[model samples]
Target chain A: MHPIAEPSLLLNTSICKANITKMAARIRGWQGDFRPHFKTHQSAKIGQWFRDAGVERITVSSFKMAHYFAQHGWKDITVALTCTPIHTAAINQLAATINLNILIEDVASIQALEDHLENPVGVFIKADTGYNRTGIDAEDFITLKKILAHLKDTKKLIFIGFLTHAGNTYHARNMAQIKKVVDPALEKMLALKTFLRKEFPLMELSWGDTPSCSIYNDFYGINEYRPGNFVFYDYTQVQIGSCSMNDVAVCMAAPVLATHPQRNEIVVHAGAIHLSKEYIQLPNGNISYGKVVKINHALEWDTHDIIGEVKSLSQEHGVISANKKIFAHIQPGDILGIIPVHSCLTAHLMKHFLTTEGNFIEMMK
Target chain B: MHPIAEPSLLLNTSICKANITKMAARIRGWQGDFRPHFKTHQSAKIGQWFRDAGVERITVSSFKMAHYFAQHGWKDITVALTCTPIHTAAINQLAATINLNILIEDVASIQALEDHLENPVGVFIKADTGYNRTGIDAEDFITLKKILAHLKDTKKLIFIGFLTHAGNTYHARNMAQIKKVVDPALEKMLALKTFLRKEFPLMELSWGDTPSCSIYNDFYGINEYRPGNFVFYDYTQVQIGSCSMNDVAVCMAAPVLATHPQRNEIVVHAGAIHLSKEYIQLPNGNISYGKVVKINHALEWDTHDIIGEVKSLSQEHGVISANKKIFAHIQPGDILGIIPVHSCLTAHLMKHFLTTEGNFIEMMK
Candidate 1:
């Protein structure tokens, strides 16, 4: 096996396929479109795995991401973030060929789309269920309906549906807490869907966040499932009761640079710029940047005998406060694999993946 | 001005040059090496700015960075992080030409260097004062002296000096607190130097953390200055009284994608992926992702009249809770500049930079 000299994201392709297979099985049963958000993986090779599992549609976070996947033969895709006129050229270019869908919350974006769109495209009105980050507040369906009416009256603008990202579920403490956050949002969406059906009965509805989408099985009414993070579950997802450590498919392989037995801290080359600055506070009130797991020569990891927790990180160093016995076992040149707190940010930071099979999977630039 | 389509790191060349000039003047007066750490602004263009100000020696955080600067004609360079055997090949490769200096605390690295060094290299024994991250503790001079003695006997290894990074100053509440952190650490370094000089009389002493190096001018005993983050002082530096907002050299130009008047929040295209997850808690105990600043079309920013505080961030979105009037005035397509809480991580995350002059500067990849 090649030494994990510096911090590089590693993928276990078998585990990733298993994760995809499990999610696909659950999502396929969801009486709706299963357009997994591509923003998490952002790899065309991973998209092929999805395609092999019968997924033809996807959701992405930006125009650049959408364009990358579109060029790779994904015909149906949604740029899940709100549309901006600055990306009009790329939007127009992509809309001319494929089934492109965009999110719009305010009337300004609709106006921009109307002004600059060279080709007609489907649109999802981003209605806020409760995240409060974006989308028109779902409670304000009156204004949303008026906008929908305006869109219906516009030429060639396909008013597809209402979409949302229930991001509040990310902060949930447990499955029940996740349900508490997600149920109300789903209720609000259903209420809006029923009301909007009066004018446009065929309009669809979509909502997703990894915790709510992965753990909660009753996603019956939603027209689309857009959860992205489940593909590469991280420590945060494990904490949220969405996935176990075994299900996580990606881990950052960092070279151990130095070890301090006095402090019981292991310094690794992986840090904020590699694993990202995202962290989850452990039950003991200490923050863990990522979960550290030791792997055998075959690159198979057994988290049962965990080495340490990455307690903190600077720009280029991850400080791990480990068990002294475990610390004694580590050498300076050894590679420590860290299960990142948030896989999406880690993937974004790494920009590429080296699978256990030694194939390099490129991320969308 | 070109419309700001997405988040791009904007560098104010004039302010940066002024910062370089000011710091260089301070170091020049000290009559010691002015090897400002290049890990902050990993751009060749910014390195050129340092060169324009008569900086010849440089400190980098990694071997790749050292090579990049070497390619740009920086001859005397130090890789400030602890040495690991995995990087032996690159270390030998770079040591063959440039005056490459490396940090080491343990004997394993010495053995590795002895095995692979194709050319002689300078070595600094890293000592720990209080950060507890790396380096042998200052009081552990017995171990340090043994290593130094070994290096003295070894061929191709020049034992130069003792170095310490008082990184705890990063958490200081203010300038006085920063001094409280630095003064003791410096005293400890001085004491170590006094004791070590009895045997190794020619050894140098160095200590640095941007807050201490930038604010406290008394560098009577330190032989080298290695402050990296002063080049782009950010909100953290301003809060700690190390530098003012006017001295801040870089800001992230993020496109306003949407707004929520009710929540008094504006959403932008920049998020953790762009600005990094570093943050500062506001005086009110609210965690802010970054400091938001309003800027004119000329790309000039007035930090005194602050725009807003980035209250929260996700993978691809930053939520700014600004003055209601400012929030009210913002259009969907407008751009807001954000002063990152920690400029080093922000710069590392950005990967490339776009100057206000519309030139693209590549980061050291």
Candidate 2:
């Protein structure tokens, strides 16, 4: 049965495949490992596409997600979120079956793992480098040394390397700005590695973010890259030049359900439930949370311009004010394509996706 | 297995139960039937609570959801979204087993549904009130009458009555504004019913929306009231006065992972993944997308007054600016409770809820 309207979620297979190729080439060029984050495109179908394009290792935000991808036969995995004491058993259980890498920042977390973990675990010491969310401060060498000293003899813990998210790329205004934030951070990590060589000569500097990963001409000290959103860049990435407008792999196809003459707006089937509320700061400082793209034949969308600004959103309806020129042509029953402000959140909200041909593609399943 | 941190979800069981009681009381006092919309608190546990509180019917946003609730023993269900051709089989399957109600705004949809349906399906005409979304225009009585006239002899189609979703309440500034928009719309529906009753004697008027359903004192012509968010009011509802701050039943319980003085902020585990991007416009027109609330032992949160505005959020972390006087008291590792700006999308993103006591309260399963 044909739906009265098109599904709000849409994923272009051709564009997705092209994105995978581009990300794989970038990783290969840098001589870095490609462990794409599963959180961006939680679909196993998308994961399979990644695997088919030669991606063997993967990263996920949660242990449950690791298990989700693992069930689909993914062998190597990294749970990127900090391991909580509550999830120790689940992690151990997962490790007993696959090569699982987990991240930790504090000694207390390590102690917690030591007390309860039953399986040997690959541990990555998370380093703080300006993102400042969940990592040990790089300048705090004493703290790092203390953690290394304690883990040296622990049979259950295998120190893998050091990991940094380099999330400041998200706030960067341009390529120069991204290099300004990431280059010094990479230098600091390399310096720390040199100073600690006598104690741990095998530490790897793992760093990744789509903005930095996509633009960097050099990976001087990085051993691994984890650019998840590169597979499906959104409005924010477009503004930062991380991905060209044509490179965005996913477009939410929403039906224009209502047009408000007074507001010069059209209501769409897509809302917060479909496209997440992540916003990009407009030049005027007001936010353009998302942009209306033009969905093409292959389900690929032309996202060169912002057709509509998501002025307000409810659960099931996104209130879009069509740009002056576009408003004149739009009406109820037409479809509008949207590129989310943040691809990660938008992908997470859509538990599954629909291909151009209308097949129900389950990404997580 | 224990997670390194608590999951970023919280369902206030006590507050949820209280919300149920209050909605039930209001419906009873207003002499209207309570058919709570399941889209907000999608949990079967919460739905069962409503059933136990004497609600015999409920509303869902999609057919997939209607089936989910039906499997949980909800016999009478309404799929409030516009009917489409693709969902006809599912709707027919559901109608065969339960008292299923569907909505349509145009003649083509009704014709498509009639062509594909095998069982008698209950249908309602979705009317376009002041909100101006999917519903057909009120002046199009000839079109509606033509639709009703066409369906008269179709054995598979059962014309029930007229249904209207006063979605304009989302734009209202407060309770006064919501009442101002909803009262007249309700009157319009009543007037339409009176006109239609002369030709079709068994017409019923069904109304949905938390703001319209909760604040209004009277429902003179409405037969059934369907309010979803009142089960778990969020920051938007608190501002609308449909429910008080203490009445909010669910929130995102994020861990304060790091404090960055350099950035003048603290990061939490919750982000757009947990809290959908629904926002509340402040009196000054600045937007507060989501608010940080207080999570107490009984799983009930304090009123919206305890709110600390979350200025900005990312995919994995939300940066709450400590620039405010109140945020200065917060420290790293404390849990920051967040009341989502829109509860509907946030509730839907969470596959299930976790109680304060750490039980997996599956919303679907």
**Best candidate (score: TM-score):** 1
In candidate 2, residue A137 scores what lDDT? 84
Judging by DockQ against the true structure, name the best candidate: 1
TM-score of chain A of 1: 0.97
lDDT of 1 by residue, A195-226 (tens): 87777789799887888878897665798888
The backbone clash count of each candidate, in order, is 0, 17
Candidate 2, RMSD to the unseen true structure: 4.3
> By summed lDDT, which 10 consecutive residues of candidate 1 chain B come out lowest?
B148-157
- Name the regions of candidate 1 deviating beyond 4 angstroms: none
* lDDT tens readout by residue for model 1, B1-365: 85677788888878888889988888888897788999999988889989888988999988878889889888999998788788888888898889998888778778877777888888888888888887888887689777877787778778888899999998897878887888888888888779877787888987778888787877668898988899988999988888988999899999888887777889999998889998888778999888888877877777887878999899889999878887657888788899899989888888887777777888877
- What's chain A's TM-score in each predicted model? 0.97, 0.94
lDDT string, candidate 2, B1-365, tens digits: 11325445687788888889988998898888898889987888888899889999999987778989999899999988766554667777899899988876656656777887878778888887677766766556787788888778667778888888888897776778888888778777887887788888888888888887777776788888888888888888888777777777777877766555555666677776767666677777766757776555454456543636676666666767555455566554456678888877777777788776667787762
Individual DockQ of the candidates?
Answer: 0.75, 0.35
